[model samples]
Target: MSERILALMGPTASGKSSLAERLAERFDGELISVDSVLVYRGLSIGAAKPDYPHHLVHLRDPVDPYTAADFARDAKRCMKEIIARGRRPILVGGSMLYFRALIHGLDDIPSIDPAIRTAIENEAREVGWPALHRELAQVDPASAAQLHPNHSQRICRALEVYRGTGVPLSSWQLGEAISQADQFECIALCTEPRAALHRRIECRLDGMFAEGLIDEVRALMARGDCHSDLPAIRAVGYRQVWAYLQGEVDLPTCREKALVATRQLAKRQLTWLRSWPDLTWMNTDDAGRLIQVDKTAIEPVKTDENNEIAAVEPVWADRIESLMRNF
Candidate 1:
């Protein structure tokens, strides 16, 4: 029989790590981080990576540039290894793209012609992103609808795809029939009231600052390994912090911008998660029930003579209590 793969997914500051850690203990599972920013080695403060070992897969490494493909490959490898060792694999984090790529194969859209890319980029530079978006809307409204008005890179790519392949970007994506794993189950935990989530986001940002987030970004910048355009650097906190370091904005303005960005990111995450079919949605207010249900689900297969899996129950209960206390 195929081993079970459980995904514990939610937005930033949504207590996903705590929940996943507890779940891991209960189920004898190893965690594979699905976060994009956490893949960078020195980005701990802003990424919020836990100090404890949890079978991390795509965590920060200074020497490597981690991509979605890299994550997918490593995640699959980790799952196999964990299963081989008689443990379940628990996928956790807020990276929607990574999750999507894992469950649904990334579309193999035709590569852009260099000339077309240059043409679209030149148009964006000369006419502005709005004009480029309008051009995409004229050619591929479906693709345009999936992108934000300010998402210049995707908009440019969509336009380039149309110009180069004579096919709409949406059509290519539709043509790719990706299959999901048969043994996988997804649980999406959205801790709400919306007001509470907003407050949590604000508090988390303040805590990040207190944790020396600025110095972390300064160190990253010092290495000259990343820039504003790189997807990793454009993560919610890093972009705003980078702007402040570049003198494009004051410190207070940067903090406010980061907070706003995190809120927006959380909203987007909620929206994306809500759209997932067959996802078991759980409210954070009823976390104990969720943990109980998860624990019950995994109890039957557990059979270690030393009762290692059984030993983790009290730990799970304690972490849940601590998390609820903070909540």
Candidate 2:
């Protein structure tokens, strides 16, 4: 029998790490972080990476670019290794693209030509992304439907694909099936109540600032690595912090913008997760209690001859429900 891969997904600041840790403890599992931002070395505070070790993968490879393709390859490799060792691999984080790439193979669309890219970049500078997206809609409505109007990078790439190959980007996506060679079952957990999620987002931002987020950005800038061009710097909080450092906005304004961007990201995450057919929703408030319940149910397997048990408990659904009601 093949091993199972449990996926714990939710928006940022949604207690994914806490739930993942408890799940890992319960299932004799090792964690493989699926967050794109957390892949950068110096981004721990903003990315909210857990300190403990349990098969961390796709994180902070200083020498390599952390693209979706890269993540797909590394994640599959790590999963195989974990399964070989008789441990479950629990993939946890909020990078929807990474998750999609892992589950479904990359679209076989050809790479954009450099000349075309330069031309598109020039056009974007003069006309803006909305105009380019309109062009994409005309060329490939399917791809356009999956992308936001303001997603210039994707819009430009879609246009490039049509221009270069004479085939719409949608064509590549139509018949492509998700590979099933890995033989793993994916379970996605979503925590709900939009209003409660919003409050958690706000509080998490406050905590990040309190933990010296601005100073961390300042340090990154001083190293000359924090630029808008870098994917790491483009992360929600980091981008806003960069604006403040460049004198483009004041401190208060930067914080406000960061919070707003974060909220938007969370909304998009929720939307994307809802569209995932295999996803199984979990009540965030009951997470801890579910752990406890599971722990009690499996104490016999966990206890040794000395009668000593593990320190952590399973998170329970009832506890999560209570938390949601209180929130």
Candidate 3:
């Protein structure tokens, strides 16, 4: 078998980092974080960044842009460096687009000018993203067809590519150049019952509020460069906290909105995981222990009417260790 690149992916507050740390230590692996927001500095508390060292965290200033392409390039380089030091590469985080870009490759689209992007954003602010998405539908119906009307970032990028290169984003996508899929030896998804996951999410959000997540955002705002439009500032918890700081909402309302947004984020993450190919599902309990599950068994357990998962026999550490040992 080819060398393995083990991946641990899950939704926010899913205990991925703790598990990745343990596995990395056990397997002599180096972790490369796959989170989009964790790349920026000053995003630590709200991003739920782990204290344990992981490549790709805190690498960029909050005001700077980091895209999936940048992540793919940096992650591949980090993997090579770790391998050169005779360590295993383990990817960990919930950023599905980064995973997809690394595993399946991205389109060889021309770089859109900053001015074009700025103009698009300006227009979005004026007429709203749905209006711009409608404009995109007129220009590149294929790309527009796949994007949600509210997916402003993607809509902007698709329109920018169309305007900058005079070719539709979907057309450029046809020339996608590389894939690292064959190198993956294991792709594990950490999940639990929907109710269990929601409980985890709520508990984590409350903890973040207690842990000065708002203060962390204030520190970023104090920099005077970070703004609502920046990706780092636009992150889940940070965005809601920023709104509260801006006096647009009360603390209680902000908390409620943040919790709802987080749950929605988790839902989207699970939606991506469900359609994901070659995933080994792992169920995590309240105590944060992991047990491997059959992929066929995951869907039914998640949709159970009671929102409670029946106890399944746990193979836990030994099974996982054996699987990686075989790899």
Candidate 4:
């Protein structure tokens, strides 16, 4: 039997975790989170992580850095262990970059040079990230489009990659993939309907504030070990709330900014989902529409001897549509 995993992906506030929990129960699978922020130990309410026990959640201190490469390594190990235990591994979250890293593998860029990083940060401190973004547009427009101007960490990394090696980070990805497509035998599940998703975003952000998102940020700050410049602090909701705590913005402005940031995050996630090569787009965001992970969808992904996914009969596609449709 070929190894198979279920990848449940969606934008922030799209009910992915809830659906994943139910799918895990139905399919007898273990859960693996694909989130950048969920790795941070103290980032709970602001990150909007599910209030349940899960692997890969709260794995690191907020001050520590956890790269996509790190996540891919950990995720692959967890998946193998889960499969060995006779259960499927259901990977879940909105971190699309992590998904891509796991599927396609990371590019061979030079390791982080502190001198280069400090130079980029010094430049950012002077003219801000938009100037650096314009510079990236000149060199690597593809990466710039995938990133937001306010995404200082990625923006800095892209620039560092270019400056450190004189090669574009996006260009490196265009080369060969390190992993075979059929090795994971995973099918991505996502949803659409822009207006409905936006509504959910608004409601979720409002609920986050009501649930003491500010207090959570405050607690992390009170720890004194964590700082606003850490990668975890730059996460959508926490960034805005931290600014409010720093007196950089008022409460109303913070709430407004946080909602906008989350909406933008959702939009980027949607872009990634639509671009995914092996995605099965679910028409509805309502988990009730498809209550379980139907096993039939994974059984027919025939692969050639070279381990590439082979073209199967149309019946397989139809079966997937039937089993995964939001009816």
Of the candidates shown, which would achieve the greatest lDDT relative to the real structure? 3
Give the alpha-carbon lDDT of every model: 0.71, 0.69, 0.78, 0.75
Which regions of candidate 2 deviate over 4 angstroms?
54-64, 170-184, 286-327
For each candidate in turn, give its C-alpha RMSD to the true structure in angstroms: 9.3, 9.6, 4.4, 6.4
Model 4, residue 272: displacement in angstroms?
1.8
Compute the lDDT of residue 232 as modeled in candidate 2.
Answer: 83
- Tens-place lDDT digits, model 3, residues 1-327: 256678888888777787788778777888999999999987887888888899999999988899888998999899888888988888999998788777767776766789999999899889999999999999999788766687788899899999999999877754343335756644444455577778888988999999999999889888897889788887899999999999999999999999998998887777667656666656666555543332222221232354333544444454456555654
Q: What's the CA error at residue 322 for candidate 4, in Å?
A: 10
Per-residue alpha-carbon lDDT of candidate 1 for residues 236-322, written as tens digits (9 for 90 to 100) = 898899999999999999999999889988877876776566665555542223345332322111214742222211222333333
Instruction: Identify the superior model by TM-score, candidate 3 or candidate 4.
Output: 4
Q: Tens-digit lDDT track for model 4 on 121-219?
A: 999999999999989999999999888787888899999999988889888766344345445434444333467677777887888889989999999
> Between the candidate structures 2 and 4, which one is better when assessed by lDDT?
4
- Candidate 4 segments whose C-alpha is farther than 4 A from its true place: 175-179, 184-192, 285-327
In terms of lDDT, the poorest run of 10 residues in model 2 is 295-304
Better of 2 and 3 by lDDT: 3
Which prediction has more favorable TM-score, 2 or 3?
Answer: 3
